[model samples]
Target chain A: MFFHIILERNMQLHPRHFGARLREKLVSKLIKDVEGTCSGRHGFVVAIMGIEHVGKGLIRDGTGFVTFPVKYKCVVFRPFKGEILEAVVTMVNKMGFFAEAGPVQIFVSNHLIPDDMEFQSADTPNYTTSDGSVKIQKDTEVRLKIIGTRVDATEIFCIGTIKDDFLGVISDPSAAV
Target chain B: MSGEEEENAAELKLGEDFVKAKCLMNGEVSLILDRRLEQLQQLSEDPLNQMPQVFEKSLQYVKRFSRYNNPDAVRQVREILSRHQLAEFELVVLGNLCPETVEEAIAMVPSLKDKGRGLDDEAIEKMLTDLALIKSSSSSGHLLKKLGFGLASL
Candidate 1:
């Protein structure tokens, strides 16, 4: 009788033990859920939800709420001062040709065109320039090295020089192509 | 194994007694050597040999750590190590055990204060804080440390 009475008293003193155990189980499940979602992923999709100043949203991933900080990867490209880059001709004008490569676009002045090429006019195609030195057509590949950059209110102008190895027509069928 | 033990064995074999002296001063020579051995063990057990690049470079780092005095050498090694993809386990193990030689290499680089006669401390502090935040928020802290930023500050 005394042993039974003592057992009952111990159980009464620790009445919250069962609830605590249940809570622990729930927390463990939450951790696993979070870890399963966030682990081994290359990128994250963030959802912003709020009215004004009061914003409440959960970060969904393997990294739990406790580990609030997450890592992100960004690509940054820095070109050398005189390094040559291959680009595609986007537009042609009497002054020059516009070429783009990666995140930069450059204008090659008419004077910079190879000496052997001759510029011709056509109604259907608009304008054409061809020289044995450079075979340039619509969407022709050319190499240009950045000479200067100017940032203005309207647009950023990148000036480039079109002379050097791997700087000319890359799509010529007669050449290595 | 710890990083210090690996350092000793690699250093002894490479005949880099100079590094040993610096390690002694820092009281971390043993830890570094032991971690080096541990890395070797981990590499041997790795199934895909995904760690060969990391291991090879780590061995080179240990060897160079013994000889590194000038900032140029440190910068070179840091660049090489930063290119490779290292596992989290390897990173965690290696990040904790930087060699005294690397510390010396960092010291050799001219501080921002020494770059000019007068400088704004606020700008420098902001720059340092930004860099620190970037480092801490990065997934690969090991890569940052390999690039020669002291781990203590991180």
Candidate 2:
């Protein structure tokens, strides 16, 4: 009777041991699948999916995906040479003026300033129109050329030459009319 | 010494069997191998080997005009490097051997190839970003000329 009890106890331990081994195998497989799915290089293109605004999911492969939140922002422009661009003056200085064209920021140098205008102040240089027909003010709308570009860690600087025939202040007829 | 004595010494050193084997190797049956061996031997004797000379020439060319930092300058260098096979080889070697001189040359290769065809806006923007990384003033005119672009165009 004691020998029979010992055999029965061994049989019970066998199933428990088999179940634990199977569980461990399954867990390892799951961990491998997760890790393998996430391994990818920075430049590799990923398909984006999922519902709008909740969070965007990146489709890494057929088996797995990752998700991240998106931040909303204003429009940004990445202009190139010979591109016709419109910008509003953000700041004016003796050397040049800084303008925002969509998301891109550009500088128009003093040399590019129209020849007809004399700079009134060294600290805050104001220019008069070449024909004396218009007085250019701050926050003026202008068309520009992308002559040069410089990109830094935080910002991109585009240099425009006002010497071109097409580049200058835009006349607002609605304000006059 | 005497011609007959020299001939006898040569035969003794090489042996009759050795001469027979040499003749068999040089025979018409193996004419190609014999010719190749002769050519190699001649090259070994030549004072100025062509490959190393070509490498040295290329290095000198790169050292002379290594300014490719400016956008306009980069454009010029691209034109020059693309045109000349020797210039391209030099550019590659310069990048490998004297990295500092050839760094811009290495960066300019892709840009030159990219500009050969029309690129999308994003690609052009990326190219502009890539261009900002270089800082050299070497003339790439010779390379561009080799690529067949007109000097005026560059």
Candidate 3:
């Protein structure tokens, strides 16, 4: 899921960048520092939409650096338990397949896949149904429910399942064309 | 930690922080990214090349999954879904998936069927129908544009 929420950060600026483009420097620095970083509480920060506020700079006596509190609105992608997500399959193996829904990595174990589908080992690995009407392989889009999530300081890993109704292959790159 | 509560979509238990946060539909995310991309293009000589990996992947995901491409259609989807008195999370899920049947919608986000929510099968059907109409109208308009371009090229 994606959220547009306001977040606050204290930015440190070197005294050399204190001139006319101070605001520009701060905004660019914030983008460089914040975007792509993940926190346990906020998930992944995809982009900095806009800067809400920049507090007065407080100079540090030792290093000639200044700290300014910055508030910004950003788009974050956080997968929650029981939230349905559409993800692209990236790999397939005997144990399970690894899929990516943006920054989050999900593993849908073989057991969690509907029992009818069997894994086919080949040059292009995939899980296919008996009749072969349905297939899950690299690049296939699937809608799966996140059964669990592990949040690290810089990453999030999810355990997903497609065993439930309305959850399974959404689109196949091979078949679509 | 108690933070890892078992929140189920069936009852719309989306944890504490998430329950109040503003949820963005796929289309809205795409729109916001598109505008940001344009801003980057205007500001720098080479823009996309410097984009963060997260931004690039998110841009691709949202652009591919967004059901409605036009701003007007995006706004209309929110407007139409909001009328059903859906929570932000539910609204975005319904908008993103565009489920064809009430059953599918309920299966996808079961909170819509919670007894206390007071939504019935018929009302859910009506909502799905309205969403489908928006999708069809927008897609047909897209098809017409493609046809016009083809004709002009010939």
The prediction achieving the highest TM-score against the true structure is 3
Which pairs of residues clash in candidate 3, taking residues 3 or more apart in a chain or in different chains?
none
Residue B6 displacement (Å), model 2: 71
DockQ of each candidate, alpha-carbon based: 0.02, 0.01, 0.51
Cα lDDT computed for each candidate against the true fold: 0.35, 0.36, 0.85
TM-score of chain B of 1: 0.25
Q: How do these models rank on TM-score, best leading?
A: 3, 2, 1
Q: Write the per-residue lDDT of candidate 1 for residues A75-116, one digit (tens) a residue.
A: 112222333445667777667678764334578777776555
Measured with C-alpha atoms, the lDDT of residue B11 in candidate 2 is: 16
Which candidate would rank higher by TM-score, 1 or 3? Answer: 3
Candidate 3 regions off by >4 Å?
A172-177, B6-10, B140-154
Report the error of model 1 at residue B49, Å: 41
* TM-score, second chain, candidate 2: 0.22
Lowest-sum lDDT 10-residue window in model 3 chain A: A168-177
- Using DockQ as the yardstick, the better of models 1 and 3 is 3
DockQ (C-alpha) of model 2?
Answer: 0.01
Worst 10 residues of 1 chain A by lDDT: A1-10
